[model samples]
Target: MEMGAENKVGTIKPEGEIYTCPTCGYTDGFHVSFSALKNNRKAEVFLICPNCHNRFRLGWHVDLSNT
Candidate 1:
């Protein structure tokens, strides 16, 4: 999968949380791209569901201390 420049606003190492795709009811994993804001207080997440091939966006809270 190719991610465009606009889609990649930031990179976070996969560590803190495991996300589930709501659209296709997928829990195993996701094709994830994300951008953090407010000094890592929040994040804008873009996810592609592997099972349904559907794209979705999410506003997530970043837990800086977790990692």
Candidate 2:
């Protein structure tokens, strides 16, 4: 699966906090992309800034197996 390719999800509210965009320094809205893997046990994430439309790789694995 592609990490930050055309595979993307959008307009979802982020869980913890909204972050600032490194590319444009905008801090209000964001889009999210999650690539599911390992039979839905794990996922890769992408955070996109709406202001600049810049995509940021959230280089960590989400362990959905916990829940």
Candidate 3:
């Protein structure tokens, strides 16, 4: 099958955050970034699974430093 631009692995952001792909059950290789509410205690992230090329939006709490 021919993969389109959405499926092609282009320039990925250099971040170490890992996420699991719900579509293909891949546990590695995902492009993740904070989408909104970054200043708040909770935030949302945009993810693109490299294994299955599926996109996901997830909300999570931020880990604040005690310092």
RMSD of 3: 9.9
The C-alpha stretches of model 3 lying farther than 4 A from their native spots are: 1-18, 33-44, 60-67
Instruction: Please report how far candidate 1 places residue 45 from its true position, in Å.
Output: 4.2
Arranged by TM-score, best first: 2, 3, 1
TM-scores of all candidate predictions against the true structure? 0.38, 0.53, 0.41
Shift in Å, residue 21, candidate 3: 1.0
What's each prediction's clash count?
0, 0, 0
lDDT string for model 3 (1-67, tens) is 2223344433324346655565777887677655335455545455677777666654444544455
Error (Å) of candidate 3 at residue 25 is 0.9
Q: Report RMSD for candidate 1.
A: 8.2
Model 1: residue 60 alpha-carbon error in angstroms: 6.6
- Candidate 2, residues 1-67, lDDT tens digits: the string is 3454554433334457667765677877567767677666888777778787766665656876755
User: Which numbered prediction scores highest in TM-score against the true structure?
Assistant: 2
User: After TM-score superposition, what is the CA distance of residue 38 in candidate 1 from its true location, in Å?
Assistant: 19
Can you give the lDDT of residue 30 in candidate 3? 72
What candidate 2 gets wrong by more than 4 Å, as runs, is 1-18, 38-40, 64-67
The better candidate by lDDT, 1 or 2, is: 2
- Cα distance off (Å), candidate 1, residue 50: 0.7
Q: On a 0 to 100 scale, what is the lDDT of residue 31 in model 1?
A: 79
Poorest lDDT segment (10 consecutive residues) of candidate 1: 6-15
